[model samples]
Target chain A: MNMTTRVSRLRGDRVTLAHGGGGRAMRDLIEEVFTDVFRPPGREDQARLTSEALQEAGAQLAFTTDGYVVTPVEFPGGDIGKLAVCGTVNDLAVGGARPLWLSASFIIEEGCEIALLRRIAATMAAEAEAAGVRIVTGDTKVVEKGGCDTLFVTTSGVGAIPPGRDIAAVNIRPGDVAIVNGVLGDHGATILAARGDLALSTPIESDCAALGHLMEDVIAAAPGMRAARDLTRGGLASALNEMAAEAGVTVELSDEALPIRPEVRGMCEILGLDPLYLANEGRAVLFVPEAQAEAALAAMRARPEGEGAAVVGRAVTAGRIPVVTKTAFGGTRIVDMLVGEQLPRIC
Target chain B: MNMTTRVSRLRGDRVTLAHGGGGRAMRDLIEEVFTDVFRPPGREDQARLTSEALQEAGAQLAFTTDGYVVTPVEFPGGDIGKLAVCGTVNDLAVGGARPLWLSASFIIEEGCEIALLRRIAATMAAEAEAAGVRIVTGDTKVVEKGGCDTLFVTTSGVGAIPPGRDIAAVNIRPGDVAIVNGVLGDHGATILAARGDLALSTPIESDCAALGHLMEDVIAAAPGMRAARDLTRGGLASALNEMAAEAGVTVELSDEALPIRPEVRGMCEILGLDPLYLANEGRAVLFVPEAQAEAALAAMRARPEGEGAAVVGRAVTAGRIPVVTKTAFGGTRIVDMLVGEQLPRIC
Candidate 1:
């Protein structure tokens, strides 16, 4: 753990094939930039982990992984590093697991700036700390220029789920209230603007925060919570459809009750996009029994990451379609799963 | 898992941005190609795992990750998918853990052939099944054409280490014996030939195989085994140097006793490469007490993956350098860590 003793041995400002050759250069880059920031417990090839949570009787391990290939490595509110950590963390959290440990592997293109990598590592470290997880093991590989985009990160996480807590889409029941944590499409809108392809400006930042803590709070308030899905790539619409299909129920959404930022709405309108299917990194739809809906909403609203909490829909008895939205004018329309790409590399 | 119930709904032969957008296309590709092949237990974002091994008192978890970006997605005797699984599994096995589960994430280029992806997935499934592990969770991201090579895969693994077993380089003693499972450099040589840059064809095939069962057999025979390291990117020389440095001892190898093929030796000589530094995907250097060395060798030689097992060297008192070799001519020479790239993306 004496990181200071391993002074910078890197000789160049950018990555090279040698840095991934399992040689002195690779060791130098890993030690100075990665190990120094992440501070894992050992230099072993694999991390040894033990926790009281794992020792508990009937405890289950939750494992998930995500690959981050965002267009711009660094975005307004978060970089690929933060997104990688948060995305994996949220995946675990939504499954009702206490996010614990993560392993991050980076595929860096040769000639990528060393400074940028350091920044990304720092951001990953900060985000992991805030999320109460340790990045215990990692690997780095440098590909030749043009072999890959600047950098891509794949983070896999392991969490512990307490005994008797079964949360899954199949557990969702009719009459369960669906709640969203915040306004949708901020992340998608932010990335669209950041790419500068649309030639429009906006003061929007990605809502790319980790939701483990918020989930813990809501679970505490509503023990009857059935399931939760992070509104990520396919957004709320896709999540709802999947949940409905799995539970063999129907999801009815109150279109007017959906919370969306003015800028995101404007961007969707200008681009002829439906805000319902736009991705959101930090948003999720939670299904709680009707009796505890108010408690879940209040618990979510109490957290900064969930200040925009609102009840957007409910699960009803099976109908012709999986998901439908009731408009402000009183008519209902199918809100199907996204058919094709509206935006690529949004995560 | 009722995989047959979900028939293929794929529309095209090539992957497009729509297949990575978390929509219907993505679902179709994942279900028909990935989920049907892997047959995970659930459709949730994370896998819920429970095992008697994890519930044991004093048991510890082992976690590791690696990114595979070998130049040719498909190489002689193996593809990136097979390499990805074996690399991570070997990392955990060498740490004295029984690898239990794996999470695979792929960054695939747009327009990549779907048929090729199916082949990779099938290979991964077969390998995981042979290794006694499950590919329980995964993610896929599609990058724009030219944003990445045809494909890159990153795999993370979780394993269980029973109580009282601590295998690490730091455990090496002055008299520990070093043994290798087989000949070195076949994987590196095979990749070099597969790339066709040298236009030199040889009968060499990549020695890529999972070594978890082999390690288990060795440990059962030699309970006092000190450490084990997979001879991966930097091969035997680098692994020895690392072990020597960590244990504060010197490693002395008998150059006459090194097991290497004639074709590999010729390839190394022609390319000005050192076979000692050439990578091996299925080989490992194991350290055992002198008394247990014979037992370890017998156990390894009994396995198909380790039929070429041989005593390569022994740890000795600290010398001027961390690693050295005794030549056939009875002269000693230092064998330091590799300094730079010998073969890029040799994985």
Candidate 2:
């Protein structure tokens, strides 16, 4: 098939089993799909690995692993392949680890066209390169039809954490400022839109990207920052709740200061889903001493990934639970850690 | 509720959402149904953090992770909890790693009774202890009902490989002998029976157990062994195929030498499933050099876990494909990796 013909056919729908197999169909899927999306960056930025092992080792190493079982594998903005790599690299960066080597394992349903599997692998390899991570080892297994959806990816990453750095959500103290790297709920909303169940209108695409460089700058600006965690499965609200629970202190998020894109807010309102409980594939919440909040915010703004970075809340000793403001009415309310998945099959 | 009354209510039934919530209902379900059936020594075998870390760094480390979504959470012989711990640990052990710490993450459907969640966790903790492994960290999340079944478990394990030992399937030579640690297909058969289809009447329970000590013995006895792998989701047939493909050799087996419980064989026949393709959570396969095969077999025989160890096959260089089995009818045929899952959600 001609390049244009293949590209047209590939972009028209959700991913099928053929997208993962290692064959010709796989190649077309990668070139027409991932390569066109996650191209190399045009900026220079510092990267760090942030897991406990790297934090204590006084060395730079990136370590991350993520599983993806997103239904309708291909979505409006991305697919499982892109999410898997970005997810791992982002974890490494937020943990002060440098994005490095990655290993991917695929559990493909049987009769999945080999061409499709290859495409996903190729797309994954390309995304790894975009995020500056290398694909080193891989495994593939075929499950009988109905054993799984189309495919599931499990990725493990190894990166080097920089020296002389310590960061953890548990380190936050009363008066520490909570700075979000960027806007919220874009990914969750974008995915919901692609599902077409809500029948909502408005442009929304997943905010999926690597944040290693953004973290490096903020850490450099405020080396003594209290903590950092990627606001993922639980979103900003859930992330704050976990920090509060772990640190044994209440966290108060300012609704007025929180950053939510207009499109995301509109969708959340219409869908009856709280943006606070939504998910994000590429965003982080950092706790910094109030004095350094401005410097940290400025540092975040200086990076490509942190253009929308802003101070949204503060850690407190009162309340004994996570609390947030109702942006519309200025009403105070509980920002509970997501007890159950509002949407399962999310990354 | 009285023990008899509660027991009668739970036997051979479907799991409800309330069973997974972390509440009073969750507690009762665990205590009444699961704990009553799969209680480990002191009920400590379930997955629970034992300490800050597990084991001192020594030899190499073997690590593996598995996600379980087996249908019918509660089975006749074992359940998802027991299978999750034992399966991952077995993978590490067969790879020459002394299993150490385990990390568990659970996804519970909303409204799942808390009692069921506790039971699964308790079962996991007890099983972990039985295998001499510690669960160091865990995370739990709830998903909307129908987003997943009642529950799903993802377990990751770390184990230390003994020093001065090298085992890789590629090391297998033309004359290397292949021995199985125990009987096959009990676990798969029991799961099939639990499905209540085909009017199957097998009383076979899963043969799931941790096989670390057994591996240590074999490694010590046959220092020059080629490689080892536990037969799990894809059964001995697929594992041997992977080894053959990786090592660039062919494996030949005799039907007469393979170990299978009569119940398991009968179940396989009735269900139209091949025992070779069915999973075995408790068993392992060792490829030893011809000169050390006898020693390896003797060592395996001494271990309680390996009491049924038997030499079932040999590796040959002349064959192109990885697997071949001689039938009871005196004919040889290719035994390929299963095309798809024979028993979905097996491990």
Candidate 3:
């Protein structure tokens, strides 16, 4: 395979208007980069499944969507493709559903390399396979050369929940414990370094991964799990605050218990950024009953995606502040929702 | 309400970085333009219903996704928002499902006008309501000024079909009768004029309408329905050829029976373009048994979207060509898929 992970026998290295024209060229592009990698066995139109997708299997479905615009397309450890697929699958998993199907839509600029697109699709297919989900259908469109930066991908997922299961943000209980699956700020820090805006050097890699398998274990272990969330754009801080406020309680975090890599912490310190608000692609937060907290933590730590699991906080019955933190100095401070991140286009 | 429709008391006319931040500005933009127009009754945290969307009643569903990037976000009859909703809805409708829920994801440039976005959302909400579907979940992301065009919207839809229902392109039978729902080439002609690329003075309007309601009636009436397709990008020519090739039969069309608007024909004649290859936003060609063709035509013509319905073609048992036409001049001509569409971003 080439560096971009595909044999290029099509047209130019860059995408042309014909690639999106709904003709022979469009069909060939879809087949080469998308269908060849994403399709399972015994599928006629792998890229789209336009006709076969019409078949229906009876099941109650959970549907969700997310758009990934992370610049540099290629980050330290993962590219936009991995983020798009894993992100949507995790969204459905955290919603208490077994994600079964996905639809990937790509909006590519006229000048993007075909090889890069194929590599992205390969990454997405691999991630989907690992997550035990299928990219059943997809669409592709190419715009004029300067009409877009490079590419943007949107993955919308559908999943089915068991009859007795119900998961939502407002299910938080007073004595629930907050647990994080893995290290935080690695994705944000890696994207920052990849942009070369700070000119810093570090081998910090993004924690981009699909958490479906880990979530299945946690859910099975902690039968009393109240709520769960995957921290993406707004990171762990935003997630905890939303859950606390919805349940009419205050969530208190132990600053020293947060799972942060020393490298990510140093990077944040040098940049004057809070690790609490930094994004982590592969991390999730779960609210489990106090009785099941230990089991939940153990189950999370058993998986590769959750090797850095930690119990970070506790939920208080009544308080005005939605989220608060007890620092290493024996002082308490509020962790409000992030107002704005100067870094744009970071997924 | 001014020409833009709703009361706008937000910040600047053009969207800023704050509009996308996970803070007060982002919340306000979402509330004013998105939720206020899209939501049903009482709902907390109007920005996202991540958990609420998890509750689904057991039913078979059909899921699909499509992206709309037409130049001139607004055309003579519809905007990108309408196209995004209707296009995805029609895709599911053609697949023999009653469209139910949709996810709208927007990638906006930094400086696009907020009023324009609000109007577009209103249009989408209206269309979704007309199609008897709900915009249950949505997402918005902002990019740098030159990172994208004004905006790109991807709508992913999920629908359901009762047991014993099945639809596929390969279901086309040799003796099937072909039917079209609306005037051909109007959408393409209108888009060409909207771009002002040809400077034509045609008054043609795009046939951009949701066909789910019409499809329901047709499916209900035609018990022996074989297959159906919506002519969006490559138009009727591509759809007919695909069905014929899929079923290993020959499609024969009568030029005199094909429906066409006078203005659209004149415009196409002036531009040396073929109507059969032009795009249509609100058209579907169906294959039905000869005994049920009349019932299908009557059901289609009963709806506004199918007012210009016509029985334009038939499927032959065997022939070398997949699609052929008997011309008005008493001659036969081959109707092959266009190698490339001159109208690149028309849809």
Model 1 per-residue lDDT tens digits across residues A313-334: 9999999999999999999999
Off by over 4 Å in 2: A1-72, A97-123, A132-164, A248-256, A268-277, A316-347, B1-61, B107-113, B138-149, B162-164, B267-274, B320-322, B325-345
Off by over 4 Å in 3: A1-9, A40-60, B1-9, B40-60
lDDT by residue for model 3 (A1-347), tens: 44576565587788898888876678778888887888742222222222222122332356788888899999888999999998898888887777778899999999899889988998999899989989888889989998888999998987766555666678888888999998898998899899997898889999999988888899899988888888877778878877777788899999999989999899889889888888888988899999999999999889888889999999998687899999999999999887764457777
Number of the predicted model whose TM-score against the real structure is largest: 1
Candidate 3: residue A299 lDDT (0-100): 95
DockQ of 1: 0.90
Candidate 3 residues B186-293, lDDT tens each? 888899998886778777788998999999899899977888888988889978877787888999999999999888888778889889989999998999999999
CA lDDT of every candidate:
0.94, 0.68, 0.82
lDDT agreement of model 2 with the native: 0.68
lDDT of 2 by residue, A170-253 (tens): 677888988898999888887777777768765877777777778778888888888888876657876676677777778777
State each candidate's clash count. 0, 65, 0
Better of 2 and 3 by DockQ: 3
Q: What is the lDDT of candidate 3?
A: 0.82
| Candidate 1 chain A weakest lDDT stretch, 10 residues | A1-10
Question: After best superposition, candidate 2 residue A318: deviation in angstroms?
Answer: 3.5
Q: Fraction of the real A/B interface contacts present in each candidate?
A: 0.90, 0.02, 0.44
